[model samples]
Target: MYHYTDFDRQFIHQRAAQYRDQLERNLRGELKDDEFRPLRLQNGWYVQRYAPMLRVAVPYGELSSRQLRVLSKIARDYDQPSAAVYAHASATQAELGTPHLPVGHGHFSTRQNVQFNWIPLDKSADVMDLLAKVDLHGIQTSGNCIRNITSDALAGIAPDEDIDPRPYAEIMRQWSTLHPEFAHLPRKFKIAITGAEEDRAATAWHDVGLHLRRNALGQIGFKVLVGGGMGRTPVIASTLREFLPWDQILNYLEAVVRVYNRFGRRDNLYKARIKILVKAEGQRFVDEVEAEFAQIVAHDGGQHTIPQAELARVSKHFLPPALVQPAQAATTNIAFEFTDKEAADYQRWLHQNVHAHKNPALRAVTLSFKRLGFAPGDATADQLCAAADLADRFSAGEVRVTHEQNLLLPWVQATDLPALWLAARSLGVAKANIGLLTDMITCPGGDFCALANARSIPLAAGIAERYQDLDELFDIGPVDLHISGCMNSCGHHHTGHIGVLGVDKDGREWYQVSLGGSDGSSLSGEAVPGKVIGPSFAASEVTDVVEALLDTYRAQRLAGEPFIASVRRLGLAPFKQAANAVRHETRDGGQVLHVHLSTVDAATD
Candidate 1:
């Protein structure tokens, strides 16, 4: 919601121009691939499996309708590979048993970023120019530097928010964007913040997590958690500080990142995360960070300390944008009347997708991008434009990209919910499946990412195709079913109640299933990594394995217990047995391995 100043506009345009020159030099052969690699990464361009991937940052998941339209334009005009590349990709997909690989579409990522997988590297400069015109860029969205700063999607508008975190996030954005000090750290760094009591942002899974809250005297400050991350090692962040005055947040962050820069591993890419360092050093790491903070305040004079005037300047930009509502808008319950079947569907959507806003007259509504045919989070260019149109009509020209890979209209007038729902339903995005099993968080695995060991999209598709009945989903209840291509955790599989991870075994695709992971929600209880059930299963058995796990839960759970609660209550023994029971071996002449409880538990253990 922050409007760009003239200086900001000029700065972005110059960056675009600079990138154009660099791209030109690289294309002319003056800059070699190795020389151009870091420069291209600085601008958020990556050479993925088949084509270039552009990661466009939606700052704290906020986007204007104008920006959305620009994104739609990019998807329509430029999100395509060359004919030869397309032909080869199609052939590859055909071999993989997936025909019609899509083009001219975009994916919403778990970190609240938008990704275009078909953009050509040669045409990237032109795309950068278009992004500059709309005050959007992908800078700091990639590379080993600090990536996008993420926060709760309902930052300022949440009913339980203690303070609007957008201002702080914006300030940090300005402070960290291309900082010479942290331009190249050991590995990618991430920070997530939340102001609400409920942990919607999954702050505990970030490298640096901040909780904006008040002390006993009502003085605002931050509860800082450091070294939390997911990869080979999943770690809940250690508390760096119980409370640091809000004014010194920037200063404290400086100290924390400075320590990581000095000590974090640079030799091995696999063990380079701050989580690894924190785990290895333990208390020593905490002592080092505190000492660094003391040094920054004493010797550095806390140059990054935020002044009240500066904070106010940023805070005013995030105030509710102009939203006009009916004079007598319904504040209690929706007043829409419908026939029996119609009313049942509308009530399901209202209960699942509509969320309370701080303003009594406004509501936040999520447009479900999870449906049949298309992969989760994949939206075509036409759908993007349609979403922009819906935002313009209902949300005061603003839309939010949520961490769940869906678009949220944060300014929907409470009384206009009926009309908005009708329009969204027409777009086929009103599945009323928010938090349900079908609303999975998935990544474009081996299909697009070169780093992926196996494909994630088709697995997600298979599961979705199997569970089309709304009654079944409602019965299963809220569960985070996250899938990832590899250890990068792009789809955040480690935090899912039922985690699906794609891996490569003997040059063939295999999947490992994990259970009981939580993302630190009130429903999840705490942020914890899931435990593996048993040996990796063949791709053919994954769906059956999931069915077996769910079946075990269904048979054993107490009345009305959610899937995650059941998995927690009855340890992993029953689920592991269930998962292995139906797992038919595809290797060694298709022999079946009968698994007993002792062998199953021992295999996983």
Candidate 2:
């Protein structure tokens, strides 16, 4: 709910105008493909298989209703017609209903941005124009720069928050937007901040994750972790600073990035991320960053100083909206009643999607975009508008995008949850599966992404469909199932309780399953990375293999134990045995090959 200042608006408009001019020049042949490539990528445009993909930034996953409406309008006006080859990430076009827009629907990403898959090059400028009108842009969304800063969706109003981290996140966003010193690094960098005791933002998976903490004297500061990432090599970040004073966070961050910029590998793109540098250098890397921090502070008093007034100014923008008194709201809603089915469903929804808020009268509700047989992170234009309208009615015209690819009305009054749930259900965005296995985090796989080695959408869909039953899902309990199309780890597969990675095997798609990954802080003091099980399986056999893993968990798990905890307790022996035991026969009678399902284009719901 941060409002754009005059300076902010001017900066965005200037960038949009510059990009427009640059795009026109490139289209007119004044610039070659090589010349235009970096320019386009910096603005979040990618030339994929069929057309350009434009990823628009939604800072820290916060958006106003007006902004959401503008996004919906962009989909309606500039999107191309849906294609058979690339429809929903989960199901075929025919099965999910052919989307009129080229991108089918706005594909929400794990980074809290929505990607348009089939954006035409010429019209990308128009898309930029549309985005500018609503205080949104694609600045720093791509290229080797600090991408959009992400924080907990429940930042300002989470019950356990020690301090609101959004202001700090915004402060970093402002400072890093176009910092010349670190503009072109060895590779892209990412940062996440979590204000709550719970790690909703998956801080450990980011290049730098900051957990806001309060000292004994009640002064807020940060616990910094660095070098964590997922790709060909996934590694958990290590402690950079046990506690950094809040006011000096910016300077500390600058020092860390500087160290990475100076030593991060430039020889190979595969080894370019800060994670690799940290791994290669070990404790030496941390020592260098600390030394840099000291030098920065020693010279010129302080390179970066965030005054209290500035913090107040940013915090004001994130102040929670006024809400009705909890007692009054409870009394008013107490008179209401529900039918048997409605009561049961509401209970399930309340248990799953609804979460506690800092204000007693208010509750944060997660609107599940992961419906049965649909892509994990997709929202049609109509659905977007509907969400905007709902937010307007219930959440002070503000909505939030979760890193998990769902919409959240963070300031909904507890009394209004039933009505909001009904409205969300009507729009097909209300599913009670938050934190459940069905609530998978996935990326646009081989079906839409040219970089992918194998199709991931269909496989994710198959897994979701196989466990579509709510009774089964609830019984299975909380599990994070993350799938990636390729090693880019766009889906953060390495952080899931159950991780699925797509790979190329002699021109065919194969999936490698990993067990016991988690984004949340470990109950065991040490950070754990997901370990890959046995060999990869064919695309057709993925769901069955996952089922086998799940069955193993169910059979061996102790009462009330979560999936990840069970995996940690039992190790991979049981899962490996269960998965190896399940077998599927191929159509070529003599030659046995396992084929569980077809591609997304040919598959049904």
Candidate 3:
């Protein structure tokens, strides 16, 4: 993990002081809501459905044990103490003339983001001061700027990855942070980097996705994807440049951002993303702009190539920890006996959570969030503290955050698996579903987010509850059920095997179902929904629909067919028919509408 330097410390402290004064002015009524909105956004504070929400940037999703402890402390002291209790109950009670809802403010771990809800804006500067003292800051968490650059969280530890992408991601972070050229872009931009062969980072749906690989000549290079984004107009990025050498990466990226900033629409906030620009102007125009910018930068003596001294400086910060001899051999613990049921549960967790590291004796263990009857990506203060303790004891004080919104201990010894799992279970972090269907990637939807049209976390929990039988889910094979509350696609619905997108139709929340979309090296573009299922059922009914869809896929699939493959082969008709049948039969007096199959046979036809 990268530690903050003295310069970083001073910069954050100064920024905090400035924000304190702004807060005072706003409280004094000198600044109206409209006037204070930009300032609050820049400081990562938003007036959400509750009190206030503060999104903290976990750059590249890496956190030290100390940082995790700081977050835990913040959750306990400043935010809501309980996992699901509301912070501004008094205010809500006063406004509504009734009792407040019992809901807790918890931490939400996104693919490459962490958000803390129910913050007090007036006291936020004090919180910022505490964070700065711990060498943590929230500088670019929001605003119309380049957001936190995300990379594969299992970068160096994943067995199938080509290289560690954190170093490059950090380099990009420093260059893009407060860059004057892009600070005034039409809308927020996101960048993702992936080193793994499997697309865990959802790179295909980012504004810029950098797939890192070594060339045949033994030189580092990147496959650049541009114009990939999710919103009202979802478009899977096209390969803009294949095999861009290491030295030319930054210059090329600069060209891309510059083109979007210059030509991307600003008249309509809804259509301001780079995807809209790519669609309206076509790839040829985007290519021309890139070429023009590249030529100009090249004429200036290639100023954007990472300087040798800077590269060396940043590389030293990311050096792997000193290698340690394993305390015990991998096979020595194979036949070890355990009497306690918790111990046996720990053993089962080890089988699912642990992964092989580059070092033969060491393993990378995942902490899954897919426990039955809990919302994915949520952690309480005590759980966070417990995770920090486990990291310190078993993983050399380092913790990783995954793109699936799970935590990772990247350097656990194979012999320590049982002990680590025991500690994890105590903290509610031990779940035996890493890549399984229940280990879904989700977002905070209508429950908290003001922009969300429907509730996503509840929907995810409902789906997990329906598939509570681990044996049944395992037999079904790998299937991603991603739900996004809105078109922003925060949950990455476009890439799931069974994608559910929430929408608002005539002021009522409904879901649109899509199938056969994938996030991988060989990308599948967004699949349009076969039907718009009206919102009329209780929470349990939603899960029933998912169950029907899964059963339909199982019945229709051929041997060795994955969920995505089956959906692609049979189209969305069969799944739609099955889901409607289940809805009608399971719930009496419920109507099942026949969804039209417009392009069902297009793949074969």
Candidate 4:
């Protein structure tokens, strides 16, 4: 909701102009492929498997109606022809009250950004121009620098939130954007912040995670966690600083990254992440960071302090809207009526997609992009526009993108729930499965990404199709089934209750399974790294394997036990047995060798 100042707008346009020149040069053959690769990547352009992919950053996952319209326009006018079957403009244009243009739709990613898969290199500059029109850009979205900072999707509105993390996130954004020292690092760094009771932002798995909590005196601050990441080496971040005063956040962050930049490995690209550094040094890493913070504070007489005016400036932009009525009073007073079908459908959605808001009169609704048959996070241009229109009508013209690859209408009145659900259903986004198995987090695997060792979308589809029955999913209960095409962990498989990672074994596509992983939300221990169940499964058996695991959970779980809790209690032994039973089916009247349980090789591509 933070509008750009004149200085911010001017700075973004200038950067766009610079990138446009670089793109023009590259296209004219003045720059060779190798020479232009870094330039293009810095601007978020990648030559994917079938076509070019451009990722556009959505800061803190927040979008205004105007920004959403701009995204729809880009999808209409510029997306390549092959993926533009539903790229009609009249419907979206009508909703946006703008002119109809022919283009393609965009895919939202788990990182809370939009990616256009079929963009042409020639149109890169044009895309940049379009994004700049809405005060958005792709800078820092790619490269070995800080990527977009993520927070809880329901950040400001969550009922149990101690403080809104956006102002601090924005402040960090201002400090980290194009910071000269960190422009190029040994590996890309990521940061996440969460102010809610639950770790909705997956703070435990980030390079830097700021968990805000109130002290005994009711002053808000952060519980800083560092070195947690997933890749070849998956590690939960250790507590770097237990309770960092809110005012010194930037200063503390500066010290942490500074230490990393100075000592982080640069020889091996695979082990260059801060996580590796933390692992190697252990307690010594924490000591070094604390020492650095002291030095910084001592120098220049505590000069890195955040100004109260600056905090106020960012905080004003995130002020909650006035509530229409108290939620309890409204629910009690409303004369509600519903048809049988409507009541049943609405009830399912209300239970799955709606979340409590701090403002009792308002509820946050998740508009799921993970409908059956579509890619997990993709939304057609019309769907995007329809969401924008619905947000304008019901949520005061604001929408949020969740780190789980879903869209959230953050401030809908309780009274408008039925109308919003109906409209969302028409757009094919009302799937009534927010935390269920069908609501998976997946990456664009071998189908599009060149780095992928196996296709992930098909695997995700197969799994979703297997569990399409809502009754079965509800029975299964809350489970995080995350799949990644490779060890890059773009899909965050390392944090799922049921984790699946694609691999290439002897030039054949296979998938490895892990269980008991979580996204850092538990009454007990959370963010527990998953253990590999057994050997990799063939593409054909992926669904069968998932079914076997779920079936085992259904049979073994205690009453009302969640999938994660079941996994923790039962351990990997039961799931491993189920997977092994399914993996050794006789083929062509021949007995196949059963895969033995072993540690997953992180080095596998």
Candidate 5:
């Protein structure tokens, strides 16, 4: 866990004070909406569909229990819609055929951000003050600026790590934060980094991705990728540099963004991402970046080159906390026996939720937030505080927000598995569905987001409703069932094994189903975008269609093949035919319609 320095604390408190002034001025009518909009967005405030939304950045998904408690406080105190706002929002959603909107909860994103959907504008300053108290703020979480830097959730603890990428990610976080030159790019830019051989961070789908590795001479370097993104157009980033010295990463990153800032599209919002620029220019874009890098080095001597001492300073902050020190831990060789039924349940939980840690005595455990009723990744105020207490009791007072929308306790002793499992189960977060179908990656859809065409929460619920049988889920095996409200791909639906994108067809919600996409994880193999099967399915037909695709795989798959492998080996023809066969019109009020058709809700648990 990285501790905040005096400079960091001072900087954010000052920012909080400034935001208070700006917010007060806007409320007084001295600053109009247009002027206040950009200012608010810069601070991660958004005027969403029915209310103001706040996105709080959790750098690389790391959090201290104290910070989690503060987030819990914010959710309990500020994440509420006004009476009028709630009434209007409820009526609007009723017409849309979605479930009643839930409030006073924090939704964790695939990017490792916590979003509060119902916070009022007047209290935004108060929320900022609360966040600043814990050294948390929403800086650059929105707008055409470099967003929060994301990395592998198990960055410092992974067994396969070549170099812990946290220090480097922290370095970039410092460099990119409020950089005046790149403050207003053509559009939002994103970066992901990973030090492990496995691509758990999904770096291939980011604007700029870095893979940390050691060179032949044992010096650290990075393998860089540029232009990968998902939306209307999905691309796996091209290799920009095979090996960039670790020290010069900031300088090289500067050149890459510099070239993009100079040439990226401004006229068309649709074509504004760096992916478009890299695709349009191809080798020329790469060459231009290289030339810029040369110029930066030759003319200015690469002022951003990181020094060894500075790296050491940043690395020390990320070192394992005292609670994880093996010598200080209690050790015993006696193995506790379990009852047969207990053994069966505990083994399943261990297999699904526990991951290997570099430390032999330690294990990384994911607390499943995905269950019936609640939206995936959503934690209520009480749940958030419970998680904080769990972190304090079992995980060295630190919990990590995973990109898959779960909280990971990274320092649990292997011997404490039984006790932790019991505690997490009591907390209702031990669902044993880490990479299962029920553990779907989803975004707050039309119910909350103004940009969405459909609702994802209930759709996710609908799908989850059908998979209540743990035996059936484990039998089907690990699946990345990702959903997005729109083509924005905020849910990374483009890279899901089964990708579902919500679209508006004549003011009705329809879903496009795609197959054979992957996020480049070891389980998912090399990165590739999914291909749509056929015409978009009506919302009513989506759940049946998803079942049809899986049925198709089960019917055709070879022995021991997973869903993704079956999709690749069998091709999309049979799956397409099966999915299309399930599409049929449903009549509501004697009118042909694709109803929102969600079966799960906030009360489903």
Candidate 6:
């Protein structure tokens, strides 16, 4: 874990003191709500449904054991002992759990980013004091600020990475932390860096997604994507700079943020993301902004220069784990032991859950959260603590939160599988259905989020319940059933193999189903939904519809065909027909059409 420098310490101390004064004034009613809103927001405080929520930036989801302990302590001391901890990019509260005290502290993988929900307004200063002592601060966690600079969690360790991205991420973090030049942006901005060949950083879904790559000259550089984001209007980022030199990253990013800060919309909150700005201004305008910033950087060589000394300094902090000599191959490992009974199971999990590591003997294991009945991406406090323990015991005392809302033990020894699996099973984190139909990425709809049109958690729960048999689920193969409450696409419904987006039709909730969406480097984004089905079905009906669609696809598909590939090949007509046929056949008949009477009766009830 990177420690804060004196400069970092000074900056946070000053910010905390400033916020403390502001908070005191607000309590004294000297500052009105309107006046205090931005101040609190700048400090990562949001006035949510129940109480003020504080988001503590974790900076790329890499947490040391000590940091995890601090978070656990924060939850136990300040909130309820059972306060939930969720992985980043998981669904909101409505999709996860009931409203409660010590509200959940979600791991916003942005795990790199840390946020705290339900921080008592009066106790916020105390919370800050506690965080400050531990070298953690919420300086640029929120507001119209360059929020936490996110990077690929597997940046350095992934086998196919071009270079370690943590050092650059750290550089960006330092440069952007309370940056004076563009703090007052028209909207919040986000930046992501990924050195991995895989787009683990959700590069297409950020304001700036930097893919570290090498040019023809063989010098390490970045492939920069800009203005990509998700909100009301979702757009995949477009390439802004191809192969920007390593030294120019900060200057270029500053230029980009500065342009958005000056030109992004502030009057309309809904249209305030950088994507909207880019869309309105056109790519050419964005190019001009970059050009302007580049000129500035060129003029002030002192500010933008990447000093060799600084690079060396930052690199030392993010140095890869010392390489160890190859250990003897364990032919009698867990995989061999479970070859007959669990081999097939383990193979499926290995294919989807395990990631290639920089070291051949080591592998990164993904703990899938998509279980039979639990909401996707959810873990109770006990589960979280257990995960922390697992990381400590088995994975070199570090843990990572994936963008898919799952935990990753990035450095698990290949030989420790059996014990780790048993321990994980004890904690309810041992589901082996990573990337299978059961491994869904869903959002919390209507339940806790004010933005949802319908409840998505129940929908996911219903689906999981329908396919409770693991054998049946595994047979279905790689199926992604992503459901989102609204068009905001937080659940990434647009990228599911079978995407379901909840919509409110009049007063009744309905679902729109799309096919062939995927979130990966080669093929990202899905086609628009071909069929809008149901004015909301009963839980059983929803499952039946999904089953019918799956059956239809299975019946018509070729061997070795994935759901998305089959859908793409066969088109959505068969699936749509199957879904509608089931819905129509299942619809209750001979029901009286007394709309006025029903309305009155419903109101009375």
Against the true structure, whose lDDT is highest?
5
TM-score of each predicted structure versus truth = 0.95, 0.92, 0.89, 0.92, 0.95, 0.85
Among all windows of 10 consecutive residues in model 6, the one with the lowest summed lDDT is: 596-605
Off by over 4 Å in 4: 81-103, 323-329, 332-337, 523-525, 586-605
Worst 10 residues of 2 by lDDT: 596-605
Q: By the lDDT metric, which is better: model 4 or model 5?
A: 5
lDDT by residue (tens digit), candidate 3, 138-244: 77778778888887767777778877788888889878888998987888888999888777676877889898988888888899988877767778777787888
**How well is each residue in 1-605 modelled by candidate 2, as lDDT tens digits?**
77899989988888889999999999999988778888888888887644578889988999999999988887766667345434443344233232222354688888888888766788888889889888999988888888899999888988888788888999999999989988898889999998888887888888999999988888888999999988888888888887889999988998899999999998987899999999899999989988988888898577697899999998899877776755532422433468888777888988999888878788899999997656888887888888899989999999888988998889888878888878888998778999898899998876667677766677777788888889999999988888997788888888888889988766666788898877765432245568988887776677878888888898888999888889888988999877666533422222212212323211000
lDDT rank, highest first? 5, 1, 4, 2, 3, 6
* Model 3 TM: 0.89
For each candidate in turn, give its C-alpha RMSD to the true structure in angstroms. Answer: 5.1, 4.5, 6.3, 6.3, 4.1, 6.2
Residues 369-480, model 1: lDDT tens digits: 9988888998999999999999999998888899999999998888889888889999999888999988999988888787777788988998898888988888888888
Better of 4 and 6 by lDDT: 4
Candidate 2 segments whose C-alpha is farther than 4 A from its true place = 81-104, 326-337, 521-527, 583-605
Clashes of each: 0, 2, 5, 3, 0, 16
lDDT of model 1 at position 429 = 91
What are the per-residue Cα lDDT tens digits for candidate 6 across 1-605? 57788977877777788889999999999999778877877777765433456677777767766666676666656643222333221323323333322243443322255555556678788777777766777777666778777777676788778788888888888788778887877777788888887776777778888888888889988898888776557677778878888888888887787677777788887787888878888866567777877686777762876787898898887765553434643321454456465666556556667777777677778887666545666554556667789988888778876666777888777777666776776777777777677777776555434455666777787687778776777678878677887676767777677778876666445667766666554433322332343344433356678889899877987987767778888877788788878668876741211000011111000
Better TM-score candidate (5, 6) = 5
TM-score attained by model 1: 0.95
- Poorest stretch of ten by lDDT in candidate 5: 596-605
Off by over 4 Å in 5: 324-340, 584-605
Q: For candidate 4, lDDT tens digit of each residue in 355-430? A: 8888777889999888766888888788888889998899989999998899999988888887888788888998
* Candidates' C-alpha lDDT: 0.87, 0.81, 0.72, 0.82, 0.88, 0.68
In candidate 3, list every pair of residues with a backbone clash.
84-103, 84-104, 85-103, 85-104, 86-103
